[model samples]
Target: MNELLKVNYDSDRITLSARELHEFLGVKTKYKDWFPRMCEYGFSENVDYRLVAQKRATNNPKNPYTEFNDHEITLDMAKEIAMIQRSEKGKQIRQYFLELERKWNSPEAVMNRALEYSRKQVQALLQTNEKLELENKIKDQQLNELKPKADYYDQILQSKSLVLISQIAKDYGYGAPTMNKKLHELGVQYKQGGQWLLYSKYQNKGYTHSRTINITRSDGRSDVRMQTEWTQKGRLFLYELLRKNGILPIIEQN
Candidate 1:
């Protein structure tokens, strides 16, 4: 029922003039300078205040016909002004302004903002879901291309056996270096002595097989060297590991 509370308090288009505001709250400060300083303190025009041209007082001899700018402030801006005034009247009006604000910003206004935010969040989630579906379609298409060959290997993978590096590459349609790179990524490091050995954690894990081969050097010296192969379990393990990571092996046909 207060004079300040009686304005065109439209839900989304609420505003009040500076003169009307000062008169209602009994603010006697020279507001011409004060309002600009208040705006400088992070209050934005149109968002917090709007400057409008009003005709000067008819009694003014020199400026009666001229237009002067008056600020039409939002409730939020009025509250800010009340907070900055260093007087008991300021404190009283601040409390009164708070009550007015509660009436204006309570239930319905708060719900409108909340609903708008929820709508945006839902739209974002829909966009993200669409992107994921597109990626899944591409991945499914790639997997379909490999399905015919992958079916045969799926059978061979069930047998208990050890295969040489060359055989592994041949079966998986990859180079020896690429096979080794994948093994390394799976935490299977080549030993320091230039022999392919599983790391200590994978030792005796039935992931590897080895053999010794004798070769004569250029100096007519023959040395026995060890060669490592992948076990059936190891092959199956690598296959699944590579497949799950989006790496598809080219299937070799008989």
Candidate 2:
């Protein structure tokens, strides 16, 4: 709650500027002279302190910009140096650092840090999910842009091959009854007494043919029936007609 001296808690370590510490403690000796004397107390470089650059004004018109060496000493080193000072300001700064360290390592502080880490992970996951959703949307848009062209190619290739009504229905993810019903609704064909036949307008388009089948009824009476089958042209016609009405085979669906 009170500021005694500036403390740096960056670089994954708690540290203090040695020069700032000297000025705060009101040391009468020059920093260049005082710091060397402090180092004589068996303190090690990079372990007890790290060398850092401190910019300075040379106070000369010829070379105004210059630099001086400084050190960022760990809190433990700073506490020891304060004790070595054996002065009123040194005692105050040392006690301030002790209290700060106690609070920094408290259980409440640790839990807060863990919660902050969890929040960061959740944010990262949400960002990743958003990216994937955008990618899928783009893919769907590209597929929709190309669907009509792909369906045209499919019709060209498939219509060249003879196929059964049930097989064609299967390709569209439906059954014969559904296909027949759809074709009937579109005026492409009609159901007669016992079979489906092309409408009069489409009958002479070379799209279909009727085959006569001889079968024995369950009563052992012989009967003849007409089975109408589609040609490749008829299948292609159906494809274009269905596509115009916004019905598509499974292959052409998004």
Candidate 3:
């Protein structure tokens, strides 16, 4: 491993010793001559390379007691140096360094993978929500299908001699004003002489039924007033008449 490359981890970035890189590149020339020539290629200091220097004794015997500067360069600077060298070894070293870089795991790659995983999770959740919404819609349709039978049980099974005009309108899901409008279209006028009366043609058909009630006020004045009402059969007759003329009861929709 030392012969090929000596690798180090610093803050998750891969670094190589400058002396080891020079030796591995097998440059026969002095490092001082090679280093300055590579720097002239415009590689910025501290970005492509970080130099670590210390004072060292000179090689001269008389100057052995004195000191000189020694330094190191980074892997980027080494790659640039390898590219410039005109030798088969330099080409081999450059290829090997590229392979190392390709194999390295980066923080950006990890973050991108995490984002992709989150997107998949969100897509799955949306699909599930759409499925649930469709299921709920099906349930609502089924409930609507059962509504007419429930209305029949209330209107027919619970038989009564008479049902108020207001109750009949409610069962058909009509307000008083809308019901009056429909009745008017059928030639039946309401609350005249306090009685629901039909026009000439419908009068003989007996589509309407009413009764009279006598009431005495506190002043001792008694009066006979006709109260408007509908029987079960009368209610059915009106329902059919209005429906045939393109006016349908709400239950018919279900």
Which is the leading candidate under TM-score? Answer: 2
How accurate locally, in lDDT, is each candidate? 0.73, 0.85, 0.69
Worst 10 residues of 1 by lDDT: 4-13
**Model 2, 59: alpha-carbon shift in Å?**
5.0
User: Which candidate do you rate higher for TM-score, 1 or 2?
Assistant: 2
Which pairs in model 3 have colliding backbones? Answer: none
Q: Write the per-residue lDDT of candidate 3 for residues 1-254, one digit (tens) a residue.
A: 22377666443456776656666778776767766667789977777666765556677887675543334555666677788886887898888777666655457756765677798889999999999999999998887876774675466447767766677677678876678777876777645754667676656554456677899878999988777667677777776777688765676664
lDDT of 2 by residue, 43-128 (tens): 99999988899888888999898989889899998999999999999999999989988877889977876787798889999999
Q: What ranking of all candidate models by TM-score puts the best one first?
A: 2, 1, 3
lDDT of 1 by residue, 1-254 (tens): 46535556554645777766666556656668656777887988767777888885677776568776788888777777777776676677678777766776789977887787798899999999999999999999889867855785776566677788777776668788877877788676665576878888877878787888897888999888888878888777767677777665556333
The candidates, ranked best first by lDDT, are 2, 1, 3
Query: Clashes in model 1: which pairs?
Result: 46-49
Please give the lDDT score at residue 208 for candidate 3.
56
CA error at residue 161 for candidate 2, angstroms: 30
Of 2 and 3, the candidate ahead on lDDT is: 2
